[model samples]
Target: MQQLLAPIYSFLQCETPDSWIEEAKKPEQLKGLLIDHCNCELKAAQTAMFLVRKYAIDKQSGQLLLDWAKPYENFVYIKNRDIGVFLSKGSKKNELSGELVARKDFAHSDDLIQKMVRLIKEEFHHFEQVLEIMHSRGIEYQNVRAGRYAKGMMKQVRTHEPATLIDKLIVGAFIEARSCERFAKLAPYLDDELKKFYISLLRSEARHYQDYLKLAQAISVTDIGDRVAHFAAVEAQLICSTDQDFKFHSGAPVLNVTA
Candidate 1:
C-alpha cells in the first residue's frame, strides 16, 4: 500500500488535519461521514461523466452518458434511495451501452473519454458499494451540500481554452489524491468491514489522480508543473484551514461537536 501511496503522499502539499481525523473517528459521526461519502462517490462519477460529455463525446453519446446517470440521480436527488429498485433497475452496472465517439478535430478527445469513462465506471461502483454499507449500517442516504474543498479548488480554474480544461484536470488530480490520502489516514480507525473498503479504494483513487495529471499534461501545449504546484498550494490551504462543516473531505473541524 505504501508503494501505491508514495507518489500521492509526495503530490499533496499537506496531510488531512489531525483534527478532522479526530472528528471522523467518533461513533456519533459515522452516520454523517458515511452519508457524505455516499454522496461523494456519486459526485465523482458525475464529474467524470460531465467531463466526457462536455469536452470529449458527441451530442448523442453525451445523451447516453446522461441517461446512464439518471437512475442514480433519481435515487439521490429524487430521494428514492431504494437500493432494491436501483439494483433491479440495473443502474449499478458499469459497462457503457455503446461506444462513445469523440468530437471532430479534437486530438485529446479519445484519451479524455477513455480515462474519464473508466473513472466514471469505477466511481459508480464505489457509490453502490458505499450505499450498500450505509444500508447495512442503517444509515440513510441524503443530499449533503458540497463543502468548500472542491469549490475552493475550482475557483482557481482559468477561463480560457485548454487552460480551463487543464486547470480542471489538475483540480481533479488534487481531489483524487486527497481522497486517497484521507482514506489511508482514516482506514485504521474504522471497523473491519469499513477498513477493508477504504483500503480497497486506495489503488483506484491513486490511479485516478495519475490519470487526471496525465490527461492535463497531454492536453496542454506547455508543461503543467507550475499549474500543478499552484493548485497544490490552494488544495493544501483548503485541507489545513478551518472549515465549518464536517464532510468526508472537509477541512479541520471548527468545533468538536461530538464532544
Candidate 2:
C-alpha cells in the first residue's frame, strides 16, 4: 500500500483525512462509492473536452471530443451495453499513440491535446476498473446527480482572455490535486479491492494536476504563482465548507437527513 501511494503523497499539496477513509471502506458503501467514482471519471473526461474545445482543438476536433465522450457517457448514464464490450470498443489507446502526441501543435493548441488525451485515457481505464469491481461484486450501477463542488469552484473563473484561461488551468490543478488527496485519504478505509484501485490511480492523477500547472505556466508570459495561490485558497474553502451533497468530491457533510 505504501509502495502504491507514496508517489501520490509526494506529488500533492494536501493529505487525505482518516475519517473520509473510514467512511469509504465500509462494504455496504462500496456500491454507491463506486458509482460516484464512475461519475467522476466521466466528468473528468468532459472537463478535458471543454479544455480542448476552448483552447486546443479546431471545430472539427471539438466535434471529435464530443464523439469520444459520448460513448463512455452512454455506458455510465444509459448502461446500454455490457461493460467489457463497451470498454473495448471505446478505449483511447488508438488515439494516444506516440505519433499523435508528436503531431500535436502545442504552440497553437497548447499541451491541452496531449495532456487531455492521456487524461481521458486514464479516466476511462479507471472507469472500466471500477465497473469490473462492481460487476464482480454484483453491484448494479445507477446514475446520480452531480454535486455542487465542481460547479462552485468553476463559478469563480474570471471572464476574459489569458486570465480566464489561466484561472481555469489553476482551477483544473486544484481539482486534480484534491482528487489525488481524496483518493489517498479514502484508500486505507476502503476494502482491499477499492484500496488497491485508488492507490493505483494516485500516480497518474498526481501527474495530471502537475500537467495542468505546467500548461498554465507555459501559456502565461508573467508569473502565475499569485494566481495559483488565490485559487488554492478558494478551492480549500469549497472543500472545507459545508455542502448538502454526498459525492466523491463533495465538501463537509450537511446532514443527510433525507437519506
RMSD of 1: 1.9
Cα TM-score per model? 0.95, 0.82
Tens digit of per-residue lDDT, candidate 1, span 68-167: 8876787887754576666565543566778888998789998998899889989988988898888777777788888999899988999999899999
Residue 241 of candidate 1: its Cα lDDT? Answer: 94
lDDT, candidate 2, 1-259, per-residue tens: 4665565455444454344455556666667878888878777777876877877766666766666666677776664557666656644532532232222544737467778788887877777778778777777667778778788878888898777888888888778878887887877677787778888888888888888888888888899988877776676676667666667777665544674
- Which stretches of model 2 miss by more than 4 angstroms? 1-19, 79-110, 255-259
Q: Largest TM-score belongs to which candidate?
A: 1
Backbone clash numbers for all candidates listed = 0, 2
Which pairs in model 2 have colliding backbones?
25-189, 25-190
Model 1: weakest 10-residue lDDT segment is: 85-94
Q: Give the per-residue Cα lDDT of candidate 2 at 257.
A: 61
